[model samples]
Target: MEHPVLIAIRRAAFTPLGWFAPGPADHAPENAKFLILIGNTGPEMFRRFARESGVATKLDAWTREAVSGLAADLGATAVYPFDTDPPWPFLSWARRGGAGHVSPLGLNIHSVYGLWHAYRAALLFPVVFDLTPPSPGSHPCETCVGRPCLSACPVGAFDGAGYDVQACAKHLAREEGQACMARGCLARHACPVGQGFAYAPAQASYHMRAFLGARQEE
Candidate 1:
């Protein structure tokens, strides 16, 4: 049976990975038994939600407000993406809980949303409930004989060594990267699972632009 709190969480944002597990006590309430990891399923819904919210101008701020507001309504504490005080290990936590796995491309591959998704917020709950853990059933990349994702990158960003962040950014800055920028990461779309939830072109472009812009600022 689904926990009532989990249902309420879905009303605001998609809970891609959720489980009954205790995290660092200082970051969570006493005896926290449930962790609901929220994220954007696709760009369209998130953009619309932000527009309707009429909150902060920046995307990060809007998401923080939305997630925090939801948490407040439930009387639960909210952990944000930018929380670096204790430095939450979101990717590691997602993998350990079976909600996501490390793909050959060095990206997190979700069972239902694949790699074309983003982590937004996390909610810790005190009460435990009968629920199924989010598992990437059968590990999509494990059974595959040919790893197309590794080869799909135009700049070889996913070469065996690991993802080359600098190389990818350079390529995206050039005209050649427009295709990827418009349609999302090629390696991500090459995944056999969760193609249905792939981001629309506009959404992909928005994210790609944001990604490059952030890198430039650094």
Candidate 2:
């Protein structure tokens, strides 16, 4: 039988990437014993997103409505990476969830999806779900010495030590940046892991636009 969470999100084209029990520091939902990290593995979810909304704007809003409903039905609470004046510590939770690792590009890399996957929302349950904790896979970046992801950025936005947001944004706004804008981050594209799960061009372009837009507003 499908895991309850899997079944609930399947129609929406989401999946349980991995999960973990929340500790005191996790600031988990009140009485939340488990937090199931919800996300996508490839471009498939983007197809559903496009088909349903026609327009790709306000994905967080659409996600809130969809996943929140699922949470309610499961008697759980939903939280998102995009939440609030005080953003929830989703990156920390993801690290603990066993599927995510620190990547040179400052985005979480997954063993199976590498740079292409993304966390959409998480369902926090008061009662623990019947799911086994996943074993943390060896960090893919460890074995890859050349680390092409760091060198592929046109503006050298990622310097291993930190990410230069201004440098990245400035480049993305320029006419010459059109290639990256229409595709995705050059650094992300350079990651050798999980090439098979790379996002479809349309999906990648959508996210690239979204990232640039958010940076412009800041």
Global Cα lDDT for candidate 1 = 0.74
Give the alpha carbon lDDT tens digit for every residue of 187-213 in model 1: 888888778878877667777888898
Residue pairs with colliding backbones in model 2 are none
Q: List per-prediction Cα lDDT, in the order shown.
A: 0.74, 0.83
Candidate with maximal TM-score: 2
Off by over 4 Å in 2: none
TM-score of each: 0.87, 0.94
Quote the positional error of residue 62 for candidate 2 in Å.
Answer: 1.2
Q: Model 2, range 1-218, lDDT digits (tens) per residue?
A: 77766787776688787788898988777788989888887876777778877545577777787788778887888889888857888888888888679897789998778888889988888877777787658899999979999999989999988999889889989999999988888898899988998887888778778889999898
Clashes of each: 0, 0
Best by lDDT: 2
For model 1, what is the alpha-carbon lDDT of residue 178?
Answer: 88
Please identify model 1 stretches exceeding 4 Å from their true place: 23-31, 53-56
All candidates: CA RMSD (Å): 2.6, 1.5
